[model samples]
Target: PGLEVSMTMLAVDALLDEVAENRAHIGLAYNPPPHARIAYRASSAQPVVLLLRKDHPLAKRGGPASLNDLQAYPLALMPSTFGIGHVVSMAQVAANVSIRPTLVTNSLSALKRFVTAENFMTLVGEFAAYRELGSEELTTVAVAHPLFESAQARVLVKADRPLAAGPLELLKWIEERMPMFAPVKRPARRKPIR
Candidate 1:
């Protein structure tokens, strides 16, 4: 229990490089591109969703939003430096749909603030707005695009590197707790046999 751990937050590209070079013990990445030196310890589907205020017109519809639906709103987005932006760009190209964002920034807080303070919308992974979703102010609408359906959030480490005791233990701990961080739908329980 005396392990000293240091954490650094990096963009997806830098995070991959750090783990591949053994400069970091672990990295959490979203929709990371394949790298020969990296090994995925665990992964979960992390679909891109439309983040907007609860009172947004799309939110009032109470259904999945489409790329075309985004055209009506002023869109705020993260720059392509982050994985969410990168994936969104790729998906847009693959789907042959282009959206011009009104504001682009790397700050998550700024994105959240924009959506709440104005009628603007942003695209991000649902986990990014998990806390806000629990409150009444923010909500996410699932995006109805095939390319966005398969994005993954991954836990990664250097391939062939044996982790030391503390790091290994920490890795295990993270794996065990991953589900708590990422939402998963569990089947409803049935009544026990009568």
Candidate 2:
């Protein structure tokens, strides 16, 4: 398992529930709490929150806009039950509008594609959008809402048993090597668990 890894996509709720049930080789869940264990975060650089093409009106606005300002632009958001569902939920509350997305998708690529094809925007973790934003394929935008937060993906072993040697090795490798891979500027610092 040098380069390949096992991954699964489940709503944050289910992910938590499954992990809580303690029944699988559950390694690395994002947006965790009841949903995850063995959290591993490797970024230590500035993270950009993204929007679509610069031509999109929200991206082109004259001055800094609050969450309310983002209300007018249709979004491509993950379903509210997904990890960090609060991002959308908070944006709506702050903007004080019954805002709904143009599309909701788990596929980050699809969200990026929708933005390119339709000028719609959404907020996603900087790491998720790193390459495109770096290559100029997707433009980064600022969300005036300090409501923004980053999440740590986690790695969990199956219930009762500890991690297998190989999986444990990979986990250690990630823990030791990932910080170097972070995007240049981190949005927040990664503090060790007290």
**All-Cα superposition RMSD per candidate:** 2.9, 7.2
Highest TM-score against the true fold, candidate: 1
C-alpha lDDT score of every prediction, in listed order:
0.86, 0.61
lDDT of predicted model 2? 0.61
Best by lDDT: 1
Positional deviation of 178 in candidate 1, in angstroms? 3.0
lDDT of 2 by residue, 1-194 (tens): 45556667777666656555664344444444442343333433332255678787766764555566556777788778765465557556776767567788878788888888876887666667767777766677765555554444445444455666776677677656665433456489788999
Angstrom error at residue 106, model 1: 1.4
Q: On residues 94-179, what C-alpha lDDT tens digit does candidate 1 reach at each position?
A: 87888789999878899999998999999888888898888889999988887667788898999999999999998998887777
Those runs of model 1 whose alpha carbons end farther than 4 Å from true positions after fitting are 180-194
Model 2 steric clash pairs: 16-35, 27-156, 28-154, 28-155, 45-185, 45-186, 46-185, 46-186, 47-187
